[model samples]
Target: MSQMITIELNGQQQPLPPGSTVNDLLAIVGSDGKSVAVLVNDRIIRPESRALHQLQEGNRVELLIFAGGG
Candidate 1:
């Protein structure tokens, strides 16, 4: 079995398997990366870094998606 870690996402706790990359989380949240931004542990993560960044235990991640309002 793969290791699992607890991460906080948009103020909610989520369990993710070890070796999971940012792309995995983006998929879970149904984001396409075009209109979304990611923050990890209070630091902004660049889009290019997502594919290479692996999630760690007790990480605080926030996903902000763009929405149009008129």
Candidate 2:
């Protein structure tokens, strides 16, 4: 069984399974990151790297969702 770890996501503490990638995080939050920008621990994560971006414990993540209105 995978151990659940706590990480800071968007200023809130969230529990996720170990070895969860950025992609996995997005899925859990119900956002695909397609129209959103992510800042992980004060670092910008590119879309291509999301799948491989391993989230560590105590990491601070921020999701910037872009909304369009005309």
By TM-score, who's the top model here?
Answer: 2
**lDDT tens digits by residue: candidate 1, 1-70:** 9668889999999998888788899887778645678999989889889998999988999988768878
Looking at candidate 2, the ten consecutive residues that score lowest on lDDT are 29-38
TM-scores of the models, in the given order? 0.86, 0.88
Alpha-carbon lDDT, every model? 0.86, 0.90
**Per-residue error at 22 for model 1, in Å?**
1.0
Q: What is the lDDT of candidate 2?
A: 0.90
Model 1 worst lDDT run, 10 consecutive residues: 28-37
Per lDDT, the best of the predicted structures is 2
Error of 2 at 16 (Å): 0.6
Model 2: per-residue Cα lDDT over 1-70, one tens digit each: 9788899988899999999999999999899736779899999999999999999989999999857778
List residue ranges in candidate 1 displaced over 4 A. none
Displacement of the residue 34 alpha carbon in candidate 2, Å: 3.9
